[model samples]
Target: MTSGSLHRLTAFTTTANGGNPAGVWIGETLPAPEIMQRIAAEVGFSETAFVAPAIGLERTVRYYSSEAEVSFCGHATIATGVVLGESVGDGLYRLTTTVGTVPVAVRKRDGNYEASLTSVEPKHTAAPEALVTEALTALGWRREELDGAIPPARAYAGAWHLVLAVAEAQRLANLNYDFEALKTLMLRDGLTTLQLVWRESATVFHSRNPFPVGGVVEDPATGAAAAALGGYLRAEKLITTPTTILIRQGEAMGRPSRINVDIPSSGGIVVTGQAVWI
Candidate 1:
């Protein structure tokens, strides 16, 4: 109900200077929607997670950005998992979200808490040329900079993201977009963030996520977008199954973050990362 009850943590950080900061509030009973929204806005993070007790190893969780409530959020979930692991011991926790059920496993690795969340079934749809063109125009990107191998797509795991792969990492780094223009288009298309990426190697990628919908200029670490990307790669047959890939995000913003994605042949994608108490 108050900011004092919230736990501040940074997710997907490999160092103290990196990661996305989130506010985690766990209670025996969840608060009302308006209250949650108010708390999230006051917290002023990209997203804040509210968790309440459900059945054994299960919890009812809700995600709220400063502006509105989201279907799901990856970084907040990871942060919640680590907090629960520390208080309730390491194990798998089932989360009931607005979209669907997600399973998160928490464990201690090398004296640090690590959490992995398996997202709901991921799916992708081809993006219309007009939509892509509008987004590129808002982003100040040219069509020639896009990667032909990876076409534009609307991908979803827990939340929807527009996947745009660029040919060079520099293109991804030069991220200056019309905030109002992009936000209008994204809201019309029901997009949570734009997953702009560049492939550095077969298993490595550089990414930037613009989250104007969440009232943020950019997200240093985006777990939901990473899961959607994994689903897109698998559906497009761009990567081998049962493989692990590394994502480097937020570097251009000065807050470096890392996300490890494990893609299985069939089923939901697993996104793993570490969170630290801030």
Candidate 2:
């Protein structure tokens, strides 16, 4: 591996500096986990995806944040898929992540090689009242600011996330929170990020993710959370079955990302987006 050739890419958004940037290291062997975490910290992104070839086209991948290793990351996977598609060729690439084997399809569409990844099995559970209260306090938000339509829940696709729907768009726009308090709560509850969202319509939504535990204040685009959200909506019967939902994230952070989530009648949620090389 060349020291000057650490390849990196941004995923879930087509434009440069417009998505969640993830560092991608494609090597013959995996880097040491600690070293990976150090490099990820140096890169300063929410998560970095490392890929080591398992068998031919199949790859063994792992995600590392600045502080620790994550089970799965959507934006990183999408970025890795785009990198592979351009470096190798556009086709179906299998990434065996720590959570499970995830299949990502990459194709040259509209002159850009976009990638779509199907998440592992997703599930949701009711968030305990005390936990939600603590999170709200850490976020400096009142309980009345929450949307009554969608109750708080802890959702998991590959990683655990606390989903909270804000009542107004203004509440989502003004995002500032205590780092230490949130970090403690997230670590204690096994939360990767707080998926705060506002629904514009049945199929359109805007989201913000607070990821202090990952050593980032916020994540621009979160694919795992999107998948979990699809599962949650399906489980709660909030949206119609067999629906396509569009999620707009990272706008508040100035790195806008567009994610298309498809909820099927029965299986893992599918998240589609375009990634670009950095």
Candidate 3:
């Protein structure tokens, strides 16, 4: 596979320069693991998606960060959906990922394409106290800086994430962390990202993700993290009703992104966003 065969897109935002940039490769067959890894590293994006275009509505997809393969990736899935929509047709595509089967819906809106992905079954568990302590230490944040209401959790939809809610939005914005330390912690605990967030309102949140494990200091927009957060809230009973919430991420990095998460009483969490060509 060559770089020319890849499609560069930014997900979760319509702006040409905003959102998480991902490399989407659509071909007759998936690339070899080594080739995909090399392509991802060369693309230099947080994540690159390798997809075998669907026969009918089912497509085989794989997600790789610059350094390793991820079981699932939301932004890359959305970007692929838009690509498929433009190349195939606007509708639904069932993506078979390493983790599980995910269904992505695509449509054209306002001259740009939008995609919504339904994650696999969502679940969460209490984060290990030791892990939380070590993570806070790496982040240089005091225990009191965390939001008591939301608490800390190891949330999982397609991938595992440590969800930490900050008491104030400003604390979430000041993101200076020991990258090596955090990366070590995340690798040991098998966490994809540290979802540091502040609840702006009952249904609105501001977030920043530290993704050193992916060889990136920060992910401008993280779809898996948003799905995990929605699952975390629903599991913890923080969300009492079936509603839609807004997650505003990447703003602190100057690459603003918007993710819409719809939580139901049960089942998969729906994460929606728009991707555009960069």
Candidate No. with top lDDT: 1
Model 3 collision count: 0
Prediction 3 global C-alpha lDDT = 0.91
Model 1: pairs clashing at backbone N, Cα or C within 3 Å: none
lDDT by residue (1-278, candidate 1, tens digit) is 53325898999995767899999998878898999999999999999999986235889999999999999999999999988888887999999999999999999999988999999999999999999999999999999999999999999999999999999888997899999999999999999999999999999989999999999999999999999999999999999897999999989989999999999998999999999987
Question: Clashing residue pairs, candidate 3?
Answer: none
lDDT of 2 by residue, 165-237 (tens): 9989999999999999999999999999999999999999999999998888999999999999999999999
TM-score of 1: 0.97
Candidate 3 residue-wise lDDT, 37-127, digit = tens = 9989999999999988534579899999999998889899989988888877788889999889999999888877889999999888899
Q: RMSD of candidate 3 to the true fold?
A: 1.4
Runs in model 2 with CA error above 4 Å?
A: 1-5
Of models 1 and 2, which has the larger lDDT? Answer: 1
Which segments of candidate 3 are over 4 A away from where they belong?
1-4
